[model samples]
Target: MNGILNVLKPPGMTSFDVVAYLRGILKMKKIGHTGTLDPGAAGVLPICTGKATKAIEYLTDKDKVYRAELLLGVSTDTQDAYGKVINTLEVKASHDEIERAIKSFEGSYSQLPPMYSAIKMNGKKLYELARSGIEVERTPRDVKIHFIDILNITGNRIVFDVGCSKGTYIRTLCSDIGDRLGCGGHMAFLVRMKAGSFDLENALTLEEIKEMAREGTFEKMLTGIDVVFKDYDRISLNEKDKNRFLNGGFVGLSEGKFTPAQKIRVYDHDGAFLALGETVSDRNGKLNLKVDKLFI
Candidate 1:
């Protein structure tokens, strides 16, 4: 219970709901989710158990991929299909026009988050304010669309796949794509296919996960701790260096090993992850690595 679980979070359950279920089944309290998924969205959600939760930040910046459907005739109050219908519009656009509009968002652009989102505004959750019939001016944030593929287009329904950075809102994206085509649109459905290195192919559903816990095979689906550290530059230490690292002291690293790097992962013997550190130049004109963050 000390690793990552590739859980396929089903629709209608929030990220916290998944962890609470695991807590009841496994009877452990130190469980956390690596990322959050909306209640209406379903897909791969990495659950970290025991000490693995300490390393969640290491994977926060990893790219994510999602497959979603967009309905392009009207918009909603929450920007997704699950919300209350507050607006309707006529569709006077063609499939080719929609495809061309989607092509325009191939790179980076500014996105204005919806009013019903969880983003914080004035020390309170935006969704909380939206529930009280209050609307505020939301600032547009910059986000990158690494890749976007038009999966299907028929009549008024459009489907696509997205590879984007963290915090990219699919509901707002679909709305923008529709707006660009001179029609209204909202998120019809969404399924996250990939988060960092974990894919949905090996994801376990909620019932399957609970069954695994009952069958005493819960640990079988948990991934190794090192699996999440794939993006860092790994540096191995010998017995002596490992002792010094465990004793909490700066160690001199080889010159030109990781030049001009801000963060790197340091591992001990047998490939046990130890700490994250930054490289600095000492007064002796040599490279010295110091721990910026570490775990027990």
Candidate 2:
């Protein structure tokens, strides 16, 4: 019952909504999503259940890829098309111009989270303040943009793909791209493609999950917690060493195996996950592993 699930969340349900639904379906009291996707967004949302919830922080650092469509000449107060229209403009940019604008957004850049976002402002969520007709100065945040490529540009609609770090707002990205084109824009739709190793292709929708549960095959939908730990370095521990490592001690390493001062994953003799450990060497040139977080 403790594992990870890649749920393909549909639009109109908050990230928490998905968690609640899965918690009820699986009858598991503990469940959580690795990252939050807006209620208006749809994507590969990774849910951790039972003991797997302890590894949520490791999954959050994974890169995310998105497919977004922007509608030119219209801007909404919420930045996405899910909100009321607060301003309108005339479209003038051609398809080529729009493509160029999207290219300019590629690579590292900072963005200011929109007022309608869920970002916290003075212990209160910004969206709550936005709904109350209150406005506050929101400083821009440093977000990484791996790349931006135009997928399709037909008429006033521009579809593009973006790979970025966590906390990136695709809505603001579209807004910034539109500003460079001088035609203004608002995101019409967004579909996340990848979050860590999980992708839309391998995701199970809400309907699919329920179907599987009814068929007594729901366990197949849940993945092992180690799947989410693929990004970390793996270490195989022998029985003699496993006992030592479990007691908060480090094991010796061979030359050219792994560099010192690295966070590594320790596995039991049977290849079961033990816990996360950090490796360090003493001034006397002796290597030791320190238990950072132990599970077994």
Estimate the TM-score of every prediction: 0.94, 0.95
Global lDDT scores for all candidate models: 0.85, 0.86
Write candidate 1's Cα lDDT for 156-192 as tens digits.
Answer: 8989999998878989999898788777789999999
Clashes of each: 0, 1
Model 1 spans with C-alpha error above 4 angstroms? none
CA RMSD of all predictions: 1.6, 1.5
Whole-model lDDT, candidate 1? 0.85
Alpha-carbon deviation at 83 in model 2, angstroms: 1.2
lDDT of 2 by residue, 73-153 (tens): 887888889888877888888767777778877777879999988789889999999999999999998999998877777
